[model samples]
Target chain A: MLSRPDFHALIKENRVHSSLYYDERVFQEELENIWYKTWVYVGHVSEVPKKNDYVTKAIGPTPILMVHDRHGNISLLQNKCPHRGNQLCAYQKGNRTSFTCPYHAWTFANSGELVGLAFPDGYEGVDKSEFSLGKVPRIAIYRGLVFGSFAKEGPSLEEHLGDAKRALDQMLDNSPEGELELTAGFLQHRTKANWKFVLENETDGYHPGSVHGSIFQVASSPVPALYKPESLALTRDYGNGHTEFDLRPQWRHVGKPMYWFNTTAEKLPLYTEAMKKAYGEQRSQEIMIDGSPHIMIFPNLFIAEIQMFVIQPVSVNETIQHVTALQFKGAPDFNRRLRQQTMGSVGPAGFLLADDTEMYERNHRGALINNPEWIVLTRGEKRETRDEDGHRIGHSTDEVTQRGIWRHYLKLMTEQA
Target chain B: MIDENEIDPSIAEPVALSPEQELMLRRIEQFLYYEARLQDLHAYDAWESLWTDDAIYWIPANGENPDPETQMSYVYDNRSRIGVRIKQLKTGKRHTQTPRSQLARIISNIEFIAQNGDEFEVRANAFIYEDSLRGETTWAARNEYRLRLVDNKLKLVRKKVVLVNNNKPIYTLSFLV
Candidate 1:
């Protein structure tokens, strides 16, 4: 087994070793340290809005069932029956008042309550209270986004989020009702690469100019040429592996309302009026001008401007990314456009993400070789500055975001060991 | 067969098409074959040439509902967006299709589901194979095509491809598939 000092050597001050990407022993260590010992984004409440709604999910290979019970409380229960360790919920998602194991028919309430056993005579002196579904210990929600941590002790969700909370607040405030919905179905993008590549690419301000050059040339996207080194945009690394591509700095130049959607406030009079009434004209105008955030919360969640991505690490060399368009509760007129924009940008067949997937897969292949022993993370370190909030800020095309991710990864991986 | 005399009135027998109608059917099948050939060869420009001005291309998501306005789909493009797709593919920098995948597909079980004057609805089973740097991937789908005859040419109005792997996660589908 690799020791704490070995981890420090592998993940250096500014460069990470190639073995970190494909080493089986390192992968197992990550599952123990990074995946199990951190706060991971589970899902959203809007995904299971009604009582009796349940969705099966996983946290580092541990099966979890998030269900809205009879009392409308969402509980994170293990999808396994306490008896014989059989998996209780089989379906990905559904509506159910209670769950019954298909193997032995042991029934339990959707709220992690052990209502009854199949046949009481099968075992004597078996305490029904001892057999309730196992709870995931730590569950928290901030602005309707649900998160669960496998570790019982650590930073609370609010503390772990820190300044990164601004990203979620920006998205929620983008809605006139100060609420966001994620009812839109996912566009799953399964790629052959390390899961960290997804998070690294999420806040990557450098690759857009080169990796997605073709789409920029063909279409008039808001991101066209906005990712260059001289662009006014800033790549920020908030602590805890949380990072952001804060385009608001550059967008301040235009200051046009709803420019992110390539539409004017005049085109969306309904949304304009709703926003004006909701937060008054001045703040609404600012919200419209600033637009949505493109940021990544460490471990799994990425709020990609208009869409949300959940990165699932299947193995050392495989990953599954699920993306869904963000839907506002009261913004009915504008939700359709968000869906269209999401389909156009991020899915498997997306004009931009398809090329990105190619780059990531190519990185995975190159990481397997022994030629280059290290992956450099020293692009803009010399000139990088700090914001008032202590965020490490770099020019648009810099390695500040990636360095931040690695720094946080090293901390989590080594501290636990 | 003694049709009218021996058959019961409740039974509806299939009628033979006129020679002119048969010829039109043959032409329609040939047009479908030509379209598929263009896609396999990665002749994006020519493949796009088969579409009319008001083309609608949609690939619905996991559910039975194929509505683009409500449910999320893999690809939903109007005529203008379709033009954008073709433009991106031809930009010579799209790495997903950098060298272009060697594609071959087979289409069978063709049937005309509906027809209204010059417009017709056609459905067929499709099996497509693509090979690239990532190796081979086979895709199976039911192709739903809406075609219209304009100036004696069969032009595509809409297309909906429901893939067998629609519900599960798959790799990059950058090509015509």
Candidate 2:
């Protein structure tokens, strides 16, 4: 293990060594400390909608089977049979009352409690009751989203989320019923990139203009080349490794802006209009257009309410992004079709996302180059910083948010739990 | 083989083709075939013009449901969304279009299901093959089309595609199916 001084010295410079990306030692340490200790998102509560419904997900290197129990509670357990360490639950998702191991006929309930063993005579003195599928150390839910932590003790889920919960609230509040549910299915993609690259890409406003230039040109006519600095909202160094980019209404004119605001300033009437009527004009406007851009909940969650992109990281470098084209559950069919058309473009295979993924792959490959010692995130370095709700603001094109992520990453990697 | 007139209604219906109805059906078939050909040939601009200003395109998420509002969908595009996509495809900076996607489509079972004045509904079956950096992916589906005659020209009002494997994991769907 590297000494504390050496680790602190490397992190203090705010630049990470390239070896960290490919090193097995660093990967193992992150699994032990970061992945296991932090409250990691373990799929959404809406995924396993019914009793016995289950989906397989990975937390770091560990494969976890997430299931909905009889009482509608979510449980995360090791996807391994204790009897012979055989891999259980081969299917990605299904409704099963019990999982019977193929090797020895060991049965486990949907709750992951071992209920049966094939041979009782073989273990004459050994107790079968002592053996059960290993459960995650901590499981918690916040506003219907489920999360799990392998650590025995740490900050509560709410405490760990900190101000990030506000983003979650805004997402759920957008729904007419004041609750957001996962769409029927998800779009899964396997990309060659570090997991952090995925998180950084989601909130990195600076890249949309350059990296996705082809998409912008193809999607927009007489492409608007002017970059209005005032229209972009940049905030860096949010507590607990969080960063947010709030694009101004003007910035929405980039390619095809969301229906929330159009060229005529006509806002798409939302499902929560009653709340708007009750709150009056000022509060209603704030709630309606308070923040339209993407918000990154540090570590792994990227919530893009405008385009309907919800990304969940599966590994240190691999991510499983679930893109849902959301529509008001009770809305009219016409309105729903309209919403789907606008929202569907953000999926993994859509035109916009195709370009975005290409850039992500390029970045991943570029980072692996032998020459460069640091990936410069020094855009808009001289911009003034303004504070708002524990966030520091910079130009929309600034790399301040990326720096914020790096700072938090250093803190997590260097901190002693 | 049984005679055409002796066929059962449940198994098959009388193949009727009226002059005007035949013309309309032919136009609809050409519209769908041309649209598919454009996408297959990577002619995005030509493919985009098949829709009217208010045309709606949908690929329903649930295999059994015809409604797209309550259930999710894979691809839904309108005028603005389609315009944005066209722009993205034409943009020189798109890296995913590096090698560009090569596609071929097979369309069959063209028939006019319903008609009312200048408005008509047509249905067909399609099989699309797409090859790109990710690899080649095949999609087979049935399609329902609603068209309206505006200014003496056929324009799409709605196009609903029902994929046989609608519930399966979709590979990259970078272009129109």
Candidate 3:
């Protein structure tokens, strides 16, 4: 285990120690201090919209089963049989009024109540109420999004979200109904990189030109060059480690045809007509012109325009990302275009994300080398300006978001437990 | 904006092939072998020329779904996008291709499912082995091809790849798999 002084020495104002990327001790500490104590996104209400619907998820190293019970309430329960610590829910997802433990025929109700146990006379004094599934310490829902935390006392979900709520609303409000639901399935993938690398790559605007250079070059259509100085985009560091790159402000008023090549003018008639009908002309036009930005709600959840990323840390060096593409229920044409655009960019065999696999793997390999003690993150520091909410704002092609991540990371890591 | 009807509906009803049709099937099998070889050798130009102007290359996700519009796919490239992908593979700074993946694959179980005019619907099973600096991975899939004879040459109209483990998480599928 690293001592307090050793951890302090690893992180500095302009650089972070390379060991943070590959150290097993650091990984464990991160799960305990960060993931366990913070509100982690589990799933959306739309995932389990009806009674008995459930989805199995993980928070750091612990598996959690989120289910909608018969009384129309959602509960996050530890996926373990209280009798012998055996796993109860063996499936990823299904509709079940009661889950029977395959080990000993111990059954639990969908609402997490202990309903039955085989050969009950053998365990006479055990109280069924005390032996029910263990619920997470704290659970809350903001809009349709669900989150759970292990810490008994801390900031509420809204308090933790803070100014980042605006970004979440922007995505949901794009739907004329002011709501959205996840599609049928998700793209679950594992990569050879730390979870933080995934978060940093998602919010970092400086690397797109180099990392995905081939994608823009061969796209054969008008795609925004994120690295260009004239792009006029900016990174906003909403306090509490939540950050985003704001592209909407840059493209909303431009009036140029900025739609992705796949979502062409010819395909927009039906969807545009539907949007106009639902939200009227002005709001529909505004939604159409604005470009969606990537928003990271520190540690676990990442919300892009049409897709959502759920980060699960497997170890110090490996992470699993769950990619869910959101679909508007009412608009079939728009949903079709949205699915195509998302798949082309971030799907498993996508034009953009496939290019990132090599870079992430190489980064982890380099981190294992002991020679370089620090990785610099000092880009665009001097020109950064503070907003009214005290968030640091820098140009689109700057490392401002990375700095913001480290700033909050240091605070959480160094605080006395 | 493609009509769903244009898609080759899966033909479960197998028909007996005449001697001429069998010869055509043999030639189509040869064409598939050559196409796979070109991709393995990184012969981008030769591979690009095998497709017609309106060709479609698709890889469905979460199992095979008939509709590409409603369900997401791993790859949904039209003719122009296919050209762009070829150009991307040849670029000097493609990090994924810096130490490119070495691939070898086997195509088997060839069956002529259906035919319409000059276009023939064929089905086959494939297993691709990819080796790179990161690691080695084997991908198995069902391949459905829509081949048309244009000017005495077999030009690809559409190719749909259905992976066996489409519902599970996968690593980088950057190559032509």
Among these predicted structures, which one has the highest DockQ?
A: 3
lDDT of 2 by residue, A1-417 (tens): 553334454443335555555445565666776787888877777777888788877676577888897556788989999977999877667777788888889998888778887777886877666788889989999977778899889889999888768777766655445555665455454455566677777766666667666655554422123233545455555667677765443344443323333321134444335445555555544554543435777666666644444444444455555565443333343235435544455554565666677666666677678787566666765774867664766776677777777677777777787
A137-219: candidate 1 lDDT, tens digit per residue: 88899989899887888899999998999988998888999998887778778888888787899988889888899988988
Q: What local distance difference test score does each model get?
A: 0.85, 0.66, 0.80
Which 10-residue window in model 2 chain A sums to the lowest lDDT?
A: A257-266
Off by over 4 Å in 3: A1-5, A220-225, A256-267, A273-281, B1-18, B64-67, B112-119
Count of backbone clashes, every candidate in sequence: 0, 10, 0
Cα RMSD, each candidate? 5.7, 7.2, 4.3
Instruction: Give model 3's DockQ, 2 decimals.
Output: 0.38
DockQ of 1: 0.37
lDDT of 1 by residue, B68-166 (tens): 787679999998888899999899899999989889989887766666789887777899999988889999998888999999999999988888678
Which candidate would rank higher by lDDT, 1 or 2? 1
**What's the lDDT of the predicted structure labeled candidate 3?**
0.80
Per-residue alpha-carbon lDDT of model 2 for B1-177, expressed as tens digits?
111112332534535768988887888888778878887887877777777889888776535353465445666666777777677677655567766878899999987877878888887899988777656778899888899999988888888888776654454566667
Candidate 3's TM-score: 0.90
TM-score of each: 0.94, 0.75, 0.90
- Which candidate leads in lDDT? 1
| Candidate 2 residue-wise lDDT at A98 | 81
